[model samples]
Target: MITVKAPGKLYIAGEYAVVETGYPSIIVALDQFVTVEISRSKSYGSIVSKQYRDDSVLWRRQGDQMILDNRDNTFNYIISAIRLTEQYAQSLGRPMELYDLKVNSDLDSPNGKKYGLGSSAAVTVATVKALCQFYQLPLTKSQLFKLAAIAHLDVQGNGSLGDIAASVYGGWIAYRSFDRNWLIAARNQQTLTQLVNQPWPHLKITQLTPPKNLQLIIGWTGSPASTSHLVDKVAIQKSRQHQVYAQFLQDSKNCLEGLIRGFKDGSLDAIKAGIKKNREILQGLADFTHVPIETPTLKKMCDIAVEHTAAAKSSGAGGGDCGIVIIDKHTNVDSMIERWKQNGITRLSLRVHPVIDLNKE
Candidate 1:
C-alpha cells in the first residue's frame, strides 16, 4: 500500500487580495491532515472516506478514464485529482492501474463540523501525492504543487490556491499566486506533464523559519462558512467597485510583505503588528463590499485577544469559523481562553506541521 498525507492550512494574512496574480499571502500547515491509502485491486476499485462513508465511489479505468458506477458526485475534489494525475501519468507513458483508495481525515470535528482548515485542499493534495507515488513519478516539489493547484482549480474555479501550496510544501510559507488566465491558456495548448514541468508565471513559494518565541492560538466560533461562496461575493464587489478593490489588493500586498519579512528576520513583534494591520485592512474590505468578513462573533474574539496583549484576526474568508491569535510563547493564555469560553468560543490546540520531503522520507 502507498499512503500519502497532506496537512490542513490556515491563512495568517492576505485573504481576498491574494487571488490576483503575484499577490502574496502567509499560510501555515497544521498538524491535522487528510490521508489517502491506495492498494492495488484486480477486479475493480473503490474510493472510501471516513468522513463521507455514505458518499463513496466505485469505479474502473477505461483507457485512462475513471468511470464511476454512481455519479452522485460527492467526491469532486478526489475525482479531479485522480483524473488530472492520471492524465499526467499517461503523458509519461505510465499504464493505468486499478486501486482501492481509502481516505481518512482529521480536518473536521468528530461530529462532522468543519473548522475551516482547508479540508478540500488537503484531500486533493493527498490524493495527488498518493497517485504520484503509486505510479512512481519523480516530480519535484514545485511540479507537485502545480499539479495539485491545477486539479484544485478545476473544481474551485477561483480564489488563490495558497492552501494547496501549504499542503504541498507544509510548514509556514510566503506564497505568490500564479496567473490563472495564463494557466488556462497553457492548459489547452500543452500536455498535462508539460504543463506542470514548466515555470508557472508569478507563482512563488518560500518556506520560512519560525520565530523562536512565537505562539499561535486558534479559536472556533462554531459557525462554519463557505470559503468559495465568500470569495465569489468579494469578486462581485470587485467588479462594481474597481478603485476600492484595487486599493485593497495593494494594501494587502504591503501588509503581507511585512509579515514575510518578520519571518525572515525572526521578529515576533513585527509579525503581530502585521496581523493587526491585516485585520484592519480586511475590515475595510468588508465595509466596501458590505459583506460580513468579520462577523459579530469574530469581533468579540479579536477584541478579547487584544485585551490579552496578543494580535488577533479572522482566519480565511471568516464569515464565522476560526480566529487566529499571535503572541509570545511565554504570554499567559489561560485567562484569554477562559474569556473565550464565556462567549461560547472554544480554543483549539493546533501546532504547525513541519515540511517533510516525501521522496527523502
Candidate 2:
C-alpha cells in the first residue's frame, strides 16, 4: 500500500491576472488536506471514494467506466485524474495494470468544492503521486505537473494550470506560458541543459504561523461559481491596452514581492499591508473577474469585519466562494465569529503550513 497527503492551496496574490499573462502568484499550502491510499488489488480493478459526509461510497471501474450513485459530482475530479494518468502511462509504453484505489478528504471548508482552496488540485497531486508509486516511475516535479495539467484539462476543458503547478512545486513560483516548440528546443539544447543540471544553494523554508492573537476568518457565499466560466469571461475582455487589468496585475506582482520579503523578515505588519494591497487590486478587477465582490450574507459579514479588522476580500474564483479577512491582533475573534454565525455566514479558521517541509516527514 502507498499513501500520500497533499495540501490544499490558497492564492494570496495574483489570482485572475495569472490566468492570461502568466505572472508570478503566491500560494500558501494549507494545513487542511486530502489523503489518498492505493493498494494493489487482484480481485477488483476499481476506484472508491469516501467523502467528508455520508456513508455511501462512490465506486468506478477501470477503462473509462463510472458508477456514480450520488448526485454530487465531486468524484468526477478524481476519476478524471485517474484516467489521465492511465493515458500517460500508455503513451510511455508502460501501461499500468488494474488496481484498487481509495481516496478520503478531511476538508472542513463549507460546500466541499468552493473557496479556491485547491480541493481538485490536491486530488490531482495525490493521484499522480500514487500512480508514480504504483508504476515504479521516476517522475520529477515538472513531469508530474504536465500530467496533472492534462488531468485538469480533461475535467475543465480549459484551466489555468496554476493550481497543479503550485501543488507539485509547493512554493512560490513564477510561471510564464511558452510555446510547445520553444519548450522542446529549450529542453534539448545543451546550454539550457547545463543550466538546468547545475546545482543551486539550498534556501530554508520558515514555518510562519499566524499570530496567536490575530484572526484570519473565511466566510462562505452560498452561490457556486465555475472557475472555467469566469476564466472564459475574462478571456473575452482581454485587450493589450486594458489599463485597469494591466495595473491590477502589476499591483499584484508588487504585493507578492512585498509578501515574500515580509515572510522572510518575519514582519507581521508588512505581511498585513501586502495582504491589504493585494485585496485592493483584486477589488479593482471585480468587473473583469465577476461582480458584487461578496454575496449579500458575505457582505454583511464583511461590514462587521471592516468595523474591527484590517482587510477582507474574496479568496477564490469570485462570483461566490469564500471571503478572507485579516483582523487586528487585539480584536475579539470569537465575538466576530459569533456575529458571522448570526448572519448565516460560515466561518473557516485556517493556519499556514510550511511549503517546503510538506513531503519531508
Top lDDT model: 1
RMSD of each: 1.0, 5.8
TM-score of candidate 2 relative to the true fold: 0.75
lDDT on C-alpha atoms for all candidate structures? 0.92, 0.63
Counted clashes in each candidate structure: 0, 0
For residue 17, give model 1's deviation from the true position in Å: 0.6
Q: Which one wins on TM-score?
A: 1
List, residue by residue over 1-361, the lDDT tens digit for candidate 2: 8887777766655577666444555555666777788887653555666763343344544453434445565566777777666655655566556577778775534445555677788888889878877777656665666666656656776655666665666644434332333333543563422322332122112233444444566676555666777767766655634776677778877777676676567566776787777767776777555654456665676677776655666665666767777766676677777887887777766665455433351
Q: Which stretches of candidate 1 lie over 4 Å from their true place?
A: none
TM-score per model over all chains? 0.98, 0.75
